[model samples]
Target: MAALTKDSMFERHIEDVEKDIVSVTSGETRPAAGIDSEVANFFASQSQGPIEIDEATDRRLRWMIHKRVLLVMVVTYFAQTLDKGTINFASIMGIVEDTHLVGQQYSWLTTCVYLAILAWEFPTNRLIQRLPIGKYLSFNIAAWGAVLACTAACKNFTGLIIVRTLLGIFECVCQPAFVFLSTMWYRREEQALVIGAFYSMNGFQQCVGGLIAYGVAQIEGQVLKNWQILFTMLGCITFVWGIFVGFWLPDSPIRATCFSPEDRLLMAERVRKNETGIQNKEFKWYQVREALSDPVVWSVTLISFTNGMPTGGLGAFSNLIIKAFGFTTLQTYLLAIAQGAIIMTFLFSAAYLSKRYNQKLLLAIIYTLPNIIGTVVFLTVPTRSDTKVGLLISFYLTMAFGAVSVLNLAVMSNNVAGRTKQVVASSLVFIAWAVGNAVGPQVFRANDAPRYIKAFIAHMVVYALQVVVLFFLRLYLMRLNVLKRRAAALRESTANGEDRDEHLAHNHAFDDLTDRENPDFRYTY
Candidate 1:
């Protein structure tokens, strides 16, 4: 069946009927007009049982869905991160000389990838909404893998830039799509762990890349550079994996192929309390405006931007920094594995703590502390033989700041409710992320060389600001939740006295109301 459009009578009836449905669902007396004819009818016709199914069924179905989702997410994310991490490995393996990169050209190679991502973020998100997400993502993954493989043939800055730019364009859908998919399949509480589980692949790849790159670098083929070999090998693996995605991955719970008919219904029913309606393809302009005007949306965008700087910086240059510490190329790769360990430790721990404590905002703020301290110590600690260990430790600590970014992403996905608003909000956050990454590499000027004191100082300022934005964002959400609870209370009292308005009794579940407009909606902080 086609989805209801804005002009549908069902859509028109949503506003009036929403309160009735909320009241009925909350166990209040039925409205006098009889919700049986409209809102209740919609539910009864669509499913076999109540929207809230039995607890055992809900739990069993959640585990099944989570198992499938995490498997796909972890593998795909690991592949994506591994491909991206190749540049850092390549830098150590003589990409500069082979590509004939001149002053700041290597930096541009890194920057342009993100530049492409920033440029394509909005359009790609819109496409994700319009198309089948699983297929769209699979196609892009394959395309990027091919592009990454082509990078092996590029012998100059222009060639490298072209391939890298295409890689960026192809990969741009990844973060937003994963976040959106997580929201689609998981409840708000489960989303943080799902996102953490998948995104922690960044750390896993770092750990794996060290071992892989170390091995791949030993291949001394007369026809290709080790960097080229690295690109070709990972790219081919991803291309094959993309095919797997197309065959197996589901776009959303409703479209899931692995579940039984009853299980799929349970999946849909499970997330109604999320208050964020499931997938809606038709774009609503008002939701876009609402997302733009929301202060918390902007706060999350700022956090994405600021936190992305260190990511861009470290992703492109962490190995070089280790190399500068007088380690051989092989040794630098091994030492960088420690950075990955640190990153995984922080990300997994923060995600677990956020899940355990139910405090994403608190964890986000707390996680930034390490990066702030790391940057300060990296700058203040003298560059001596003995202090080199401290410098490396500080570098590892910078990765702890990255966990704040993971938590920030969870916060965005958790708080945004309407489908259109979530899409727009996701794109905006990642666009800021892309911009920060683009800017990050440019700051690590060739003149800065080994110490890069200026870059460290810049990171210090951004991370400090990140903590402030997180606090404000939390307070804003708390205030909104309070207001919503009060409003719902008022509606409940008024609902008890009034005769049911027929127009109001026809509320549709999929009307796609923004959280602010949906009185039943509450922000999860």
Candidate 2:
């Protein structure tokens, strides 16, 4: 933002300096989207100031958004989860035996998807920023669905890798899009639950997808293998759903047809408190530079990597791990239902804690406690028939990491600002996620199968480091908040009358400033 003189800081009105703020928004296209374009489109306008909305109206508007917006996000994420999980579910159904995936070949099948995601993250995020999100995402989803269907035709490891890589490239758009949506449609305070509700589909899909996989396995046909049937069924369903979402979902609040022009303004007003600008087509290199150097971005990147390691391992290997305990293939699928329930429970608890408390990063640490205990048991326990159930419970406890991942999404979204900066930070964290996931499956080598002792030991160290990173992330945010408050105090001491109103105004909210540039932006974690 523009540097103000001491006399201008508290003595002059912000409206007077509207003529003088080219310094503040030098590279930015000011008031991008909902605050500016929508106001122009609607004919009924709101001059930028404090948008006083009553509690009941705000509550009603939020639910109205939840019904249309949140539902679309949840279903889209659920489809993406189920589609990505085809290989995981297929593992127990004989894809390995059919494709002759000996040694670490199976692990590579899982590893390649994330490798594709890692390669596509930066380029894909740039597209997400520049294109119409709903249409672009729907096209990708539809394309991935067709690619996933081709997994049914793969006769060997190389063919499957080609399709799975395509699957990863297309599905990579879902996550960053959802994170951006949470910021666009909701206030900062409302983001946690919205993110949790959609992301919890990671678990929910396990419940539904497991049942679907089991039934498909029972199909009797030599013309198509059970795994082939499963892949084709999942891919076709996703393709149909993706086409539907293109028509049903809106690109942005400014573009949402479900709400009236007046309601759109209300929707715009609802999220203005977030200080993070809604949408800006202009890509500022400085903000990208800011995200690269920003401690908050790197802190979350490390946290995301440590968390992603175990998550990716489990994503591909959970059923295989269960099967190693001597359970039949069908039994393993049935047992994963219980694991899904455990994940759902942990996710909801984390969401509740985030909504009720202000300590988001601390809650991420606390949620990891169970996973740590779980890892200890997984590492030390004997893998006897009598100890099977105990080991399985330990597996479930490790699912508490899901809570940490979802909570981190809310924290990162809450903290980052500026369009390019948010995209850069999000892409960096997901790239770390892909790297962690790619490395994750490599640890579960075929040599260490039945009971991957070394992998569990590695998990213990990684999970511990995850907690330490989260703690330091919390401290860094708290320190940043302190500095912001110190600056606010100095600015406040000289303020009076219209100066107070000018200082308090959210006029800078849509100015496309990075979090550091916006004086009013507060760190939540």
Candidate 3:
């Protein structure tokens, strides 16, 4: 016989492989490996063995888990926010006056924190996948808390800079670790609310930190200044919380002590259904590539970058902005408490709506709109005018979108599959945030103190960009949803029909079903 052509031989091999895959997928023939048996065996072995769980017991158990986990997440995140927000609190305590730091040097503290975060986020996220996450996270929290306490003892600008740098290094693990932990515990539908509840710590810190700082500043004849006392108190509280979390928090569903064997299995199965599969044990470069290649990842990056700039500005200098309203230091702190309250309300509302209606993108746009308006008002309204205070209040209140940033995180978690991919997605999302944050504080120059016109303008432009980015992201996601639905329908049709499988097998053709095969999968865009 004449020599077979390469194309002809390749086509024959593809036809054979397709026939096998079609047979396996379509139930046209039993797979020689017995997939059902394997699945059953895998579950039986991995679980602690089955036990019946009544609905009431299941509900109670789940509630306990949620309560425990949420407590840890909320406290950890609250501490994280408090530590980061101390700059704002410190500003009022005469930190600038004491340090005599000026201009860009002042900006460097904020910039260095974010720069540290950007450098460490990816590697830390990856480490979380391999290490004992809860334990690692708790240790990190405690370490940062110790550093935060040291902040209260700083004598000059150099001391403050050193503490802030150390604070950033230890604090880097909390954001991504908390996010990954949430993914482990909650289903996709429940994620936004849980994430929101955890993220409400940001607002809660503002409220509580203001109250506490007011009290701490009153200490008489202390060895430390008021700023030092502020750091000490916050740091001690965080350290205590860290100890509690270290001993108490469960690392994963498989390791949870509160859940019975059957409940654990149910939890696993429930998550599997939502995730499209169980979490992967091993990291893979291909999985990272898959996550990085998604358009949604980039869309979220852009949205986060834009939204983060205003959020970062508010975080770094909210107190300073409020001080411009001619409020006394105590008044500024109290007003911050009110602003924190407004932020909490909006954060919870947005989160609830996003989860209830699956409107992640829409909620983002809605939250961004308020901030955009607030920024415009702050930029245009005369600084000496009373209306400027209202505009400033609006600016703080509109920052409810910071909670939506956590919602964006939940979206990314839901969209990416495999531990490696999750790590990559989390890193990129946080790096975008760090970048925006690093740049934001620079806009608030010392010269622009009472009327930060340039800073307000910068915020206005960024918020507008946020709106635009969110719009495009929503469109991209909508398109992806259409494609996914069409693909799912085709898969269903293929499963149900004989001729289609035969054709597919003979033709050696199949639509990309990787998204379906991977349960923890969705289009990032």
Which is the leading candidate under TM-score? 2
| Model 1, C-alpha of 208: deviation from truth (Å) | 0.5
lDDT of 2 by residue, 57-103 (tens): 99999988988789889998898988998789998888999998888
lDDT of 1 by residue, 99-189 (tens): 8889899999899999999999999999988888889989998999999999899989889999999989999988998988887778888
lDDT on C-alpha atoms for all candidate structures: 0.80, 0.83, 0.70
Candidate 1 colliding pairs, count: 2
Q: Candidate 1 at residue 184, lDDT?
A: 74
Q: Which 10-residue window of candidate 3 scores lowest in summed lDDT? A: 503-512
Candidate 2 has which clashing residue pairs, if any?
none
In the range 107-130, model 3's lDDT, one tens digit per residue, is 788878888888888888888877
RMSD of each: 8.4, 6.7, 8.2
Residue 217 in model 1: shift from native, Å? 1.2
Every model's TM-score: 0.88, 0.90, 0.84
CA lDDT of 6 in candidate 1?
37
Q: Candidate 3 regions off by >4 Å?
A: 1-42, 46-58, 276-278, 490-525
